[model samples]
Target chain A: MNSAYPHWKKGPGPMNSISIAFASGKGGTGKTSLAANFAKFLSHEKNVLLSDLDVEEPNVSIFFPENEKPGSSYNSKITIPEVDLNKCTYCGKCAQKCNFNAIAVYQDKISIFQELCKGCGRCSNICEAGAINLIESEVGKVNEYSSESLEITEGILNTGNIHTKSLITDVKKYRHRDINIYDCPPGTTCPMVESVLDADFTVLVTEPTPFGLHDLSLAVEVMEKLNKKFGVIINKSGDNDHIIEDYCKKGNYDILEKIPFDRTIAEKCGRGEFYYDDENYRIKMNNIYNHITGKIK
Target chain B: MKKIAFASGKGGAGKTSLSMSFHKYAKDNSLFADCDVDAADAFLLLEKEIQHKKPFYSGLKYKIDENKCIQCGKCADSCNFNAIKKTDKYYIEEFSCEGCSLCEDICKYNAIESRSNCCGELFISDTVFNTKMIYARLIPGEDNSGKLVHEVKKIAHEQVLSAEKEFLVIDCPPGIGCPLMAAISGINLLVIIIECSQSGFKDAVRLINLSKKMKIPYITVINKSGLNPDIDNNIEKYLADNEIFSAGKIPFDKEFVYLLNRKKLIIDSDILSGNLKNIFSQIKNRIEMEK
Candidate 1:
């Protein structure tokens, strides 16, 4: 075990865990790369539970290939209301109560749009005649991958499925360890919010471009609004890093670390290979880990 | 009129940059709509002067009156989202509240009142390039971004019909989720931007799968090519195997990032402009073929 950090379980087991979520408002900003590498680095001493909450396109597991073997997985389901025609009075109460517009009533006929439903059960609960019955519908699957060093739980959303939040919640409920790292989905919407809501700290990753700065600002606003403690990690940092540095300085946000723009790193990430085998990369990850544990502890 | 939307399942995969460049090249014959409400940046490059704007009220959230005599726990127990909390006074966590109004319906004292939230603002503006644009700004941390994207598209579609525009170019949000689905609806074609990285390809494939499932015909563009030859070859193989058409490949260029930092479009760059021209022409040809 690492002498500096407190010792905990050596694998996926229940403990007083501190979760850190790596998120970005813009896509392709190295959230998964940073999250995966950090989790692997931390797992050398303490038990680390890494979760891929980017249900839409989870790529964290791609970096953890175990001799081309598959992980143990199970389907996750959400409840959507189904109207019973016999009990239905066609009064339009359920339709009116649905904020998502998933249900509609017209001229003694009812329509249910399953895709639009959020599975909030409001329509079923509001149905006075007991016509609306909530039914289980599979949205995605939660897969668990384990090795001697680390444990990973990934949420894979079924194609055309929009229930990203429910599936993310299911993945978060799976397991925990000494330290949890969540690779959040891109964008500052519900899915991103759900991913970061329960994290002890959130690391906002970004590049040093205008789009990166803009989206990073939006993500900063979300973290601030949610009252989450967060810092910034500038990936692909180069000469134009002032674009983000100036903004971070103005906002007094902590610049945890920067991963320089290197072609070798990009190639390694493109091939889904770990680039943390070098001493320089290990020091950077250690700095971030120490910074986060120092603050949260 | 042909309406085409550009989307990348991964963020920062150059969807907005490419769409802006396409709109610039297509010139006055096209209109642009920024449907990525969560992180709308089309206006940054388009240089727009807002002509008309309005607050968009998406849904309602129930607020409990502090003076109401009843501090009943029924509302708290009934909320599936666990948004309701009784700490000195009954209150709702605005972030988690879905605005279902079940609490408002059950409260006999009429303590809860449904308040429509101004989740975002919609704008109809004219860009410096003489192109009319429609965009929206969703308040940070607010829900209903998908609904806002739909509203922006609906208006853009109406304007395209009324003004007799030849094309409606849309910039879609990343990820094959609700917002992307909303942006894809009613669009004649989808331009899937694939960043030439393993993560980018994986995400782009997800978006391609979604387009296929929705029966939306699309063309792919592999951006930031030459970053890795292996990834490039793999992407080519996958596209060839699936018989999917690709618009073209864009080499990895630092100039694109500099141009973006300057709030300039690809058409404004001397180096990247030529490649964008070819891509724009190919996409335009595809859209024209649809007619």
Candidate 2:
């Protein structure tokens, strides 16, 4: 089924096809909106792929119409330790060796709490009687969908699970297109980092409030440490004030774009309006897209 | 010390704004902890200088000594995280590993050695507000964010108690993940900031539900209320329906950016100080009322 795309076997696109990641340390800062619009803007000129790496809450699909389906895809699995009671000696070694306390050994048998399980498989390995085995558990689903404008792929992390980085890594295995725009999860943690780490550039979306400045700095620090090129996009731009610009000056970062706080835009989003439907917002996004492409070129 | 955490399950709702405003209102030697270590941002507003930093180690990585002649696929097969892959030669992706040490424990040839990976760094910095800010950073593709959140909160609590400060205001991370849970653990109070949007309202409801389940007393702060006053009304109605107290509503103000650009808190501005004072007084009354 994966044979339709030959580039999938050749490894991700060439280095010339710059990858831009839209990230924010704080949630609700318009990272997804920026990513969706930026993808729309870039699709006009380049072969773009909008990879929604925010697996925990995949919302990028909401930006598109209901008919849109992610193109070629793959299902990823993680190893879950399973115990076979028939071959069990009930020695309690598996429970004792498990560090996460996922396994509880009673007098006669053992129980495993799947939520707390890191899928380490120590229990199966330590089972002296070969009573335990490793089983593949569905952790996430990766979907690749294409539109007339862009190819979109997203990873949906299974609910009640915490291993987002692994799921993101699995989804990234399918990133074979150029000009990839990764919509990263909010926060400066493992999952967010996993989404933005390999990208050639990152666009930090923040509002011009105290909190926005605060989180933007953290995201900038992460990008700086990773040595990835990044710029700031102040969402709700004209609403807050100049704190973001002052922050840019102090931090030596540039304000790539300022998206004014538009009620129409929010209303459109709430109503599920596409980017092109709002011509003014689309123009703004296009300018930002051009700015990014110009910088990269 | 009153340790109040500003948290919301939904991202971009204005948790940072409330925390920053609270920091401005209670600006006396208090410890401002950016417990949203995954995205610590309070330091940016404070213009703080990092005074001390320490690497946070969460889990271990198992390194195989190839010289030990352990081509046994047992270790590779033992890891559930898919950290290990057999490709002619055995290779382990450090980011994928959960540091379970199962590979080392199962290696019969004693070739695997487990070592801790520095997930990120924790910083104790001096902010422009003259307060000590406690924050941490989690490296991308690393685990144990809950542990890091706990460590930073502990440090903030210790500082607050030692200094006899009035408040330990914290900026919490987004979502209901381990980090958010850790941020909410053992806090004196929680202020959930909710934006007036469908997803924001939904996430705020989830946060309030979680707070009730955890028995954490919380209040609501609706930001960007002017974006759509009707939506704000619905959120207010939801809060009323849920019996959650409303702290105050911050109108979508353009001047907020002016304050931010100047690196000044809104509470410090003459125009917004009166409103901020009213909000702080309400917060104080709410806490006292709860007590």
Best by DockQ: 1
The sequence of per-residue lDDT tens digits that candidate 1 reaches over residues A136-220 is 8888888888755788989999999988887887888777888899999988878898889889999999999888999999999
RMSD in Å for all candidates: 4.6, 5.4
DockQ of each: 0.56, 0.30
Which residue runs does candidate 1 get wrong by more than 4 Å?
Answer: A1-15, A67-71, B69-71, B86-90
Q: Cα deviation in Å at residue B36, candidate 2?
A: 1.2
TM-scores, all models, native as reference: 0.94, 0.77
- lDDT tens readout by residue for model 2, B126-194: 878677888988774467888899999988888789878878888888876567878887887888888
Interface RMSD of 1: 5.4
Which 10 consecutive residues of model 1 chain B have the lowest summed lDDT? B73-82
The collision pairs in model 1 are A27-B11
A1-297: candidate 2 lDDT, tens digit per residue: 111223556364766777889998767778887788778776877889898888766767767766365466566566667888899887888888777778888878789887667667678767889988877676668888877778898887654456677778777767656788899888776788778877877899988766677678778877876677888998877745477888789878878877777768776654345555467867777777777777777
